[model samples]
Target: MKQRPFARLRAPRSLAAMATAGVMALALTACGGTTKDSASNSGSGDAGSGASASANPNAPIKEGLKIAFLPKQINNPYSTIVDKSGIDAAKEYKGEAKEVGPSDASASSQVSYINTLIQQRQDAILVAANDPNAVCGPLKQARSRGIKVIAYDSDTNPDCRDIFINQASSEEVGRSQVKLLSELMDGKGEFAVLSATANATNQNTWIKFMQEELKKPEYSGMKLVKIAYGDDDDQKSFQQTQGLLQAYPNLKGIIAPTTVGIAAAARYISGSKYKGKVVVTGLGTPNQMRQFIKDGTVTKFQLWNPKDLGYLSSYAAAALASGQITGAQGETLKAGRLGERTIGANGEIVLGPPFTFEKSNIDEFDF
Candidate 1:
């Protein structure tokens, strides 16, 4: 029997003020890591350099494939929702999906999980890496054992994984964050970034683009005072938001690129003196940011549907495990209901551009 595409696939959309003219061509860089098997070590190199890269396309897709999802941290609301989407996708594919990871978002936390997955002989491992370089060693070992390694949301070094599912264009997300904050602040005043963690690959990449975007003449009046780390912790983000307010008396706004950080910052501002004075904007789900937007604590924010991100990642993992496509440039995979996705440069598949959720359209989204 022919299989239909994965269920609950939705068309990707762009928000009114969020679409950009062009995507910046950002070069992929190699991250550092040491592996046990130095002879077959996969750290950073061309496609087909690793054992998984050379996996045969005709190889049987493991039945009831065990796919382990390792997010940065367990029990995180955002991670929980996204990982659930992956698990649902696994069920649709007749595969088993399990969630495993550290409770805290730290650079080295995911190493143990990867080692455990290797011991269990899982077919594929889907991860949103906490640190790009930290997980490469264990991931390389997993690949050596013919395990399909795919990174999603947050990515590891290109050499460590077969493919990476990017939630959105990093450059676009970073620029849009600055654009949204600049608009809210009327193109001027001090702003700070409340990021997830210092070593987070995606967070650092977006922050880099934000800094680049700030150099434009239109944003000359805008100043970035500080970039704080919340480690994707609710309390840490809340306290960081408070610290920003205390440290920068004239701060006009904050851009928290992580879902956790943004939500926590909003919660802080909603109950604090900074409410209505300091605008909060960044990546957050509609349900989490809905009240903040309705109460005027936050005017706008951006995010791709994380559930969809996980869904796509799951399909991609299945495709790889099934040996339908290699992680090569120009290779295409049938992404269930989301339609076909082509591999871009550096074995990356971009889900789509992010959507800005404002009060007008925030209610239209639930995830």
Candidate 2:
């Protein structure tokens, strides 16, 4: 039996349920080639051209509209919180919404789900893509049929989606993690990044910034030793955490930018001899990391509210569907309780800064 909250933190995940859905998706996608080569960078496949659409800020939010959330994988704790909140937001706006995706974060697994969404004629498709380019073909087909594509949390390529609802700016999220680790390790030592999928757009983008941030004289004492991928699976992440420790005995810190990886790493460190010796910090849900903080496995970790991220994305999807604004730079739209947001260059809409959770304030948050 399963309980509420983050994936891999509570009871066994309902991976069996999601796998059944993913099989049908794969069947459908197999016909469409299900690979990055299925679509070319040339014009026809680069849909998400909302710039050509007109804006109407005064347009009333439509009712009974169908929107679907396609996460990197629905069987993830962080992604579950995000998609569930997005579904709830759709209800608030009088629209119908649901979440659908593969159980695994494999590169091509999400494409078939995108095809299903397109066939169902969803008014909007919100995706946190596994690979930025793998889903472009289906997304292009979706946009050609007048469906609004909004990339959230993890983005697709700019040409593949209309609006990207970023949890935080890529540079800030990446550089901040390095800065936090520097503070913990006193700016010196060897660390590694336990990431999700290697091709994960957001993960790679953030890691790039983290690498760049390290080049500055302020972080000369710190060296990034290795980057290990757990593919967003809890068991694999736990193993990767152990492997990292074995591979680098002098590793002073571990930065796991994915929620699954962070929780898994903290779980491993808490029960091992490395407890307290290796600092674990990165983007993680407060609920999942609460015990780690209390048990002294981790001193601090950071994340923007995933619920707020989904809520904001739902509204952004609705705004595009309702024609409130096109995905143009400087276009503005209401985001329910988050107030209004303006679209930035490249259709990016940032949620804001990350919040650090520590012993002092970790108990204040539930999810």
Top TM-score model:
2
lDDT of 1 by residue, 88-108 (tens): 778877899878888899999
Q: How well is each residue in 224-248 modelled by candidate 2, as lDDT tens digits?
A: 9999999999999999999999999
- Each candidate structure's TM-score, on Cα atoms with residue i matched to residue i, is 0.86, 0.88
Q: Give the whole-model CA lDDT for all candidates, comma-separated.
A: 0.82, 0.84
Evaluate residue 270 in candidate 2 and report its C-alpha lDDT on the 0 to 100 scale.
95
Which one is best on lDDT?
2
User: For all candidates, what are the clash counts?
Assistant: 1, 1
